[model samples]
Target: MNHPPLAGHPADTGLELCEGSALQERGLAVSFDIQLWDHPARAFALRFDGRPVAYVNRCAHVPAEMDWQPDHFLDDSGEWIMCAIHGAIYDPRDGRCAGGPCPGGKLIEVKVDERDGKVYWYPSADVQPAFPD
Candidate 1:
């Protein structure tokens, strides 16, 4: 698969966090629940076997973040990412809705790629491409 070029962006976004990797080798899941855009949009970064994966935190059914707390979006089992508001479960591998209110509903995928071993989001990491009132 093709990934984006990581040029200039913060070390962390709502979607992911740097796990103290100078080369950005690893990424820890982060909660964007704090920064709720008008659209409740949040970006995340994930690294699987050194591959970069970035996606928005918004669910497909309703406009909400997939986190119960800051950087605590994963379930207690740490198996799948979950939405505390509606009990939705998502596969971290593909962001596909595996369970919950909308069984088939999936989280929106945000575009991001890795460059020089670091992850990055497009239009910037704030996810505030359009300011909300």
Candidate 2:
């Protein structure tokens, strides 16, 4: 249940994810390891509309990884997050299920913030850092 220390930010600040420049607009996501309810899992962060968005890599339709290729979440149009397994499309801005299977479902969102040239993802009660500080 331990978390990393926020060196320059507040004690409630999120864990350091990556450099701000690492996420390109509508491009490959920056993947990272996490512990979801004490189980190992993966999460990803990407830039859309000049802002950062993140979500657990699991699709809502099924507890399966959604990326077609490593770090490749967005579809060919680069407008939505598409699951390679069930073909569920999600809005990257909010992780809402937009089309295909799993209607009315939503991806597990991972809160994120960008500041001081870095991106950080918040750890929740259920989601935690894989490697504690």
Candidate 3:
């Protein structure tokens, strides 16, 4: 019943709902500065991979958002995550930019963790590099 608070969640503030469950998590969004992508950039964070790994959520070429919806990020193939804004395909396994204008570009990996049954996104860094330090 005791855990740290998700005070720095990028999406919103204080216990944001992710994949909803009865569990209570403790963490925050890394991109807490901006609610939405300004120019369809890549950003990865709020991961369930033990710690958190987030990116800009953008494609290097067009520099667009991978998801069509606000937070609805995923690829048409589903096997790989795609950028909805510019059709950039990437490997969800590592957030690596696979196909699209920026062939060499990669998907920014989001960092996160699940203490109980809730998911939390890491806060954006002071600078830019995709994942946190």
Candidate 4:
């Protein structure tokens, strides 16, 4: 697969994820694609108490995507992030496993920032933006 060039260098620049209002309108959760360890990976962002939070899309219990549907991460009450596959609940603020099968396990966190009307997620040494094949 061909991937697009990363928005910016992970060390210096932040990748623009989405508009702040758009996330807010969508109950504060949205999905985006990135490169993790040189492989295609999915991630999601959420707003917890008006703050932006993000995590790798994979579940800690089992290395599987957690969203119930495309970009859907929150439960009905929109209070916690739930894994659609195993009923695992996670704390949106810190990606901690609040209650679920993956005890003492937490979702991988991706650094994110919401500023100037847009949301930006940062890549670390292990995670980077995916490029076209």
Candidate 5:
């Protein structure tokens, strides 16, 4: 299904991310990309309470990717998102920093929608689709 542009911004993602098989367990993660601050930036989506939540991959602590490995953002307990660099823990549901160096900080959320068995991401003023380099 095609979605019309929003605020002159086209749909940033397609249905490829709708494959929810990998999200059966909480904390499972998937990675995607978007344009942030006019630069290519990595973002990730994770399963939490059977729902998909996404955020810019940057850690609130020091502006670094949080995953220890590609698409690996969850800790062993599968309860929270973990930053490999500074050990920052973020609430997967809302991206709020729950503990560690990041206090009163939160991950940048990327708007996503799941409908008719498809998943799509929407771009906002601050975050847009990343062009191929």
Candidate 6:
């Protein structure tokens, strides 16, 4: 599983995730691998309300992957992020729990920025790019 480094994107601009056009409003997400707390993990980015958002794919309630289908995180209505397993819903804007088993819980968000027709995710202390910089 070798992933080529994102070409042309400097570290200061963050790691490129996908093309901005790849994410449609409430459409399929663009999934990516990450290193969460030094462990391999999955994350995804999608568009909602005309903006891009991302999160570590783990559910707030059970720490399980939440997409109902691969790259599908939004509920049927395309309004909220629904956990595939336990029905936990989260606001796409800020990853805050909107309803379900995990009251007051929130998704672990991956900071993202969209510019120059591309989407980029920023790594934090707990989250890092899966590939070496």
* Candidate 2 Cα lDDT to native: 0.91
RMSD for each of the candidates: 7.6, 3.1, 9.6, 3.5, 4.5, 4.4
Best of the two (1, 6) by TM-score: 6
Position 115, candidate 6: lDDT: 93
Could you give candidate 4's per-residue lDDT for residues 47-112 as a string of tens digits?
778778889998899989998878888999887789999999988878889997978889999999
lDDT of 6 at 108: 95
Could you say which candidate leads in lDDT? 2
Error of 2 at 92 (Å): 0.5
For residue 102, what is the lDDT in candidate 5?
Answer: 99
Count clashing residue pairs in model 2. Answer: 0
- On TM-score, the candidate that comes out on top is 2
TM-score of each: 0.60, 0.90, 0.52, 0.87, 0.84, 0.89
What lDDT tens digits, residue by residue, belong to model 5 across residues 81-125? 999998999998899999999999999998776666555667776
Model 5, which residues run further than 4 Å from truth?
A: 1-16
lDDT of 2 by residue, 1-133 (tens): 4456435553278889999999999999999999887789999999999999999999999999999999999999999999999799999989999999979999999999999999999987767778654
Shift in Å, residue 83, candidate 2: 0.2
Error of 6 at 30 (Å): 0.2
TM-score of 4: 0.87
Q: TM-score: which is higher, 1 or 3? A: 1
Candidate 2 TM-score over all chains jointly = 0.90
Q: Which stretches of candidate 6 lie over 4 Å from their true place?
A: 1-11
lDDT of each: 0.56, 0.91, 0.47, 0.82, 0.77, 0.89
- What lDDT, from 0 to 1, does candidate 3 have? 0.47
